[model samples]
Target: MSATSVSSDRVDHLWKGVRAGVPIFVASAPFAVLFGAMAVENGLTVAQAVLMSAAVYGGASQMVGIELFGQHVAPWLIVFSIFAVNFRHVLYSAAIGQHVPHWSPLRKAVAFFFLVDPVFAESERRVENGKRITIIWYAGMALPMYCSWILMTWIGAEFGSQVMPDAHAIGLDFLLSIYFLGLVMGFRKRPRWLPVVLVSAVVSVIAYRTIGSPWHVSIGALAGILLAAALPPRAALPLEAAAVEEATS
Candidate 1:
């Protein structure tokens, strides 16, 4: 391709990623705002609140951290709690790393920083569909989401209660679960995913009731990983067989 054409393609990919992230951004707005408000309410300054959103972009962990901080929990315990909540990022990084094995160290570092759930889900979906993902494309998805989160967080810190007096009453908390469910459903056709999902759900409930807090997430994820490892890999369908199956569907 000509240089101009290649540049155009890159821009197109970036824009496509941005478009893919829009729904996630919308879904996350209320939660981001809530976090900011809660952070300030719990004794964080507006600067500290926005800084947390900017520096630590993991929403769940940020919420947990702010809550723990509010309780005057030991700093080490707060850090450990945040780490436990976000340990799943290690798996996400491992899975996506294969797609960019040739990336420079700097590029890899930047990519890891942006490797949040929505970006990972979108990028993984594209990869599964056999599309080539560029760094710019990934950034397109990540940067916008990051900006929206921080912006919403600041707004929440500054004016959350006035604007959203009852964020819970509006059911904002359930949006994340619904959003994640939609992402999970996208992989329903993958033979191994359903079993893992079911197993993870069961384990999560048991762990939540017993171990509680972040342990449930870690236990559930480990259970899913172990189950996936033990199961035989599903064989790929032959081209003709796949065509026939597609036609029947």
Candidate 2:
């Protein structure tokens, strides 16, 4: 393709990613708001809470961080906790890297920073369909979600006490669980996904009750990874397998 055509295609894909990410952003908003509210309740100032949201951009890890901060945990331990919670990103990067081998180091670094669950999902879907994935497309999906998270965090910090005095009573806290459930449902048809998920959940609950906090997340993820690695590789689905399977049913 000519330079102009390539640029246009990139822009088109970028918007496509943005559109795909909108629903995820909506689904995540409640959690983001709750994170902010909880951060403030844990003694974080509005600025500190918002800054955490902007810098970390991982809702689960940030919430853990806030809890640790409130407990006066050692700074290094807090860092480790956040790292453990976010270690799954390493796997996410590895999976997406296959499609962008020639990306510049700077582009790769920026992309990795924004590589959240929704962005990774959309990118993986595109790659599975043999579509070209571009940095612009990934950024398009990431930036808007990032902005929404930060904005909601600020709102929650500023008004949570008054507006959401009883967030739990209103079920705001359950939104993240529902959102994650929806994500997991999407992969239900994939081979071996069930066993992996079940193992992860069982291990995670045990770890949470015994070891506690960030360790549970890391342990659960590692358990899933190890189980997956031990399993024999499944055959790749044919490009039209989804359509064929759907039509038969």
Candidate 3:
């Protein structure tokens, strides 16, 4: 192929990623605004709220931090709470690492900064369909979401409550959860998906009932990760051997 053709391919892939990421950003945009408003309400300046969104880029953890900050909680507990809420990113990085072996250390560092749930899901879906995870494509998807999040945060800090009056009264809080459910269901066809989902759901509920909010989310996810790692599909050699042994026994 000519250099011109290669350039065209890169732009095309980048555009494809941008298109793929729009829906995610659209779904998440409201929550960004909500965080900004809530952050301001919780005593953070508009700049601080936007900075946190830009730097941390993790919505759940950001909210947890904001709430803790509002309560004048100790700095250590607030940091620990954010870490607990974001522990799933550790699992996400581990899962996606195999697909990006060609990436340089710096590239991986930059790319992983935008590794939210939607990005991780969409990347896995792209890989499952046999496409390589190109930098152009990843940035195309990531930039819109990342930039829009900060933009929305500013808007919310400046005009969120004034515009919406009562965001929760209108049920904006449920939108992200609904969007998350869609992401989870997108992987339903993967091997052992349902079992992992069920186990995670059950464990999450149990943890919520006993241990409480943020911990339940992380603990539930950890349970699912453990199950997925320990119990491969029956087609795998170790699983096949176990099946054979059980059958003979």
Pairs with steric clashes in candidate 2: none
Per-candidate TM-score against the hidden true structure:
0.70, 0.71, 0.71
What value does the lDDT take at residue 163 in candidate 3?
A: 77
Candidate 1 wrongly placed segments (more than 4 Å): 164-249
Cα deviation of 224 in candidate 1 (Å)? 13
- CA lDDT of 221 in candidate 1? 72
Name the best candidate (by lDDT): 3
RMSD of each predicted structure: 6.5, 5.4, 7.5
lDDT of 1 by residue, 181-217 (tens): 7645754654577789999999999998998765676
Expressed as tens digits, the lDDT of each residue in 26-136 for candidate 3 is: 988988998998888789999999999998898878987887788785688788888876775776677677789999999999899898878887887788799999999
Local error of candidate 2 at residue 86 (angstroms):
0.6
Model 2 weakest 10-residue run by lDDT: 240-249
Give per-residue lDDT, candidate 3, residue 77. Answer: 74
lDDT leaderboard ranking = 3, 2, 1
Worst 10 residues of 3 by lDDT: 240-249
Error of 1 at 106 (Å): 1.2
What candidate 3 gets wrong by more than 4 Å, as runs, is 164-249
lDDT head-to-head 1 vs 3, winner: 3
- For model 2, how does the per-residue alpha-carbon lDDT over 144-244 read when each residue is reduced to its tens digit? 99999999999999998788767679776565577557656765676678889999999999999999865676699789879988999788565344323
